[model samples]
Target: MEFELWYLLLVPVLFGAGWFSRSFDIKEKKSVADETQTLYKGLDLLLDNKKDQALNSLVNLAKIDPDTVELHFALGTLYRKRGDYDRAVKIHNHLYNRADLSKKERARALFSLGQDYLKAGLWDRAEDSFRKTADLESDYKVRAIKELVNIYESEKEWLKAIDEAHILEKVTGETYPSRISHLYCELTLQCMFFKKFDEAAHYLQQAIHADPNNKRALIMQGTMLQKQGKLDEAVEVWKQVGKISPEYETLVVASVADTLLKAGKDADAVRYLESVAEKGINSDSVDAAVDWICKIEGPENALEFLRRYLSQKKSLIGFKRLTDLRLAQDPDNKELKELSDFLKNQIDKTVRYKCNKCGFVTKSFQWQCPGCRNWDSFAPVRSEDPSRI
Candidate 1:
């Protein structure tokens, strides 16, 4: 009987505790409503084109609930976009160090921090944050790898750039021959600057292995061999370029001709020129080859060759060469020579190389596009387009 009375008395106390818990639930719901209303107000301000005020309001709201992951990320992204990298880093770093974050959230936070650091020019810190993303098994792995490639490139760390490029190619299944080829070429340049001819040669070989069609590698290889007094070897490598990439022969024709002359193969050089012309050839190459022919054979022969070649395929450069040669042969004709000179200048402007990727125009060739920073973006101008001007 005493036990029953105690049990009956405890029921009202349990009921009172249940009532208090219900009241707390209601208060929690009200708190959620208030946060939602504040978020709506922030959005309203943002929609009014008051971005600074919106950010301030949202940031203040975020301070009230620091565990709101999306809010922090959005704010951090906005800060970074506004060039406030310190605030971006602060927000992202705070999120990155949160022990309550899941694996994916942690990766995302680190990725953001990495971007902030990179934009802030903190290469080492950016690399550290990106490296942390590797262990997270998120898509940030690929993103981090790509950024690391850029970072290494900016820092002139070619070996690390190559390593990261290979990993990226493997992971993303996308070819990076342009980037890899340039990296190897960069290493070759560094080696050659230090008088490390053998190392440069090795890197050139690696570059060719990475991209056999790379024009820079082919030119550098031939140049290196020529510097080492390997005239026949240089001839062979440059001849390979002529055979594979005839359009690029213009860039290396003078070197090949010199090599052939050094190796006592003048006849072979002329024949190579003839062979390159038999295939499709650029006008500059034709101009150069005809000039070479003038020195080797005779001016009459060069004139004959140009006339016959120009008859088959007409071009401004061909006309210019023909006119110049005719003008040189007859200096007494002042009016004819001046007209030819004026035409040559105009044609020279039109014949300038242009970057296919970025439309960056230049008189000389470039292995990389300066405007877009893309490798092999420039191509030889075959014809004039007045519209581009």
Candidate 2:
């Protein structure tokens, strides 16, 4: 009877232990499920325009799951956008320094840190960051190298820029011919500034070889040749600029014409400028035509050309130029003086140049746009102003 009683009491004790174990298991699973749901809700908040609350929730998630690399990346990007470079740097730096990071993740972190330093204008730090990223043999390495090129260009480290460009081309299979040519041009200019004409000429040749159509190189080469008293060779080289990029030809025509004139090629100068003026009434082209006409054809013929040109084109600048020419031809003509005054006021308020990329207008020309920071964004506007393209 005592044995039976003990068995009955043990049954209840075992049943109670089983129930406790099941309850603990359920509670533990519910806790994990709740944490997962909270993380999902945080992502929802980020998508729903509640960034502050979303960030707070994400911070909580980070605290709970500190090993989540994706969450860290998102947080770091957000901090970077918020202009908290220090925090972004800290997160990315932490990820980069982690021994547990995969090669891919480490590369990503390095790239991000490099961009962070770039935005902060810490060029030295940025260069170091990008250099480390460039060493990693990953998909991001090519991009890292490009960023490094941009950094070196900004810092005026042209040699480093050229090296990075070469690396980028080798790795990415993309041609940076124009950019490479520009780099060589910059190097040439640097050499020229120090009166190293031989080195400058070598760099200019390299620039031309990099991009045969690089007009800047042709212009510089022509100037160099002229300085060396090889006037005929210089004139021939400068003339090619017009054939290659006719749109930009207007720039070189006048300078080339002047050189031709000084070299006793007066007929060639007149013929070239006239043909250029007939095709485009742009400021550069028209100015060249006017300069030639005033010198050879007399002020009267120049004024006549301006009038005939304006009759077809109707440019405000052309009108202004004509008005000036008319006033100069007949200083006592009251009507000409009055017209010039009115046109000058109109021209003064006009936005002469605009960026093709960002549509930012400027009164003066800018090679690199102040608004978008794009190189060669501005083109000398002619009569039919580019409203948009």
Top candidate on TM-score is: 2
Cα lDDT for residue 350, candidate 1: 75
lDDT of each: 0.84, 0.82
Alpha-carbon RMSD, candidate 1: 5.3
Model 1 / residue 286 / CA error / Å: 2.2
Summarize candidate 1's per-residue lDDT along 1-389 as a digit string, tens digits. 34666788888999999999999999999988878888888899878977788898888889778789999998998798788999999999999889999988999999999999999989999999988886568979999998888889889999999999998888889999867998999999999899998898899899999999887898898898888898888888887876777788888888888789778999998887666555537777888888888888877888888887887888878888888888888988997788798777778667677888888888778787778777888765456656643
Q: Which 10-residue window in model 1 sums to the lowest lDDT?
A: 380-389
Once fitted onto the true fold, the runs of candidate 2 whose alpha carbons sit more than 4 angstroms away are 1-54, 281-283, 330-342, 345-349, 357-389
Score residue 284 of candidate 2 by CA lDDT.
Answer: 55
- The window of 10 residues in a row where model 2 has the poorest summed lDDT is 380-389
List clashing residue pairs in candidate 2: none
TM-score of each: 0.77, 0.85
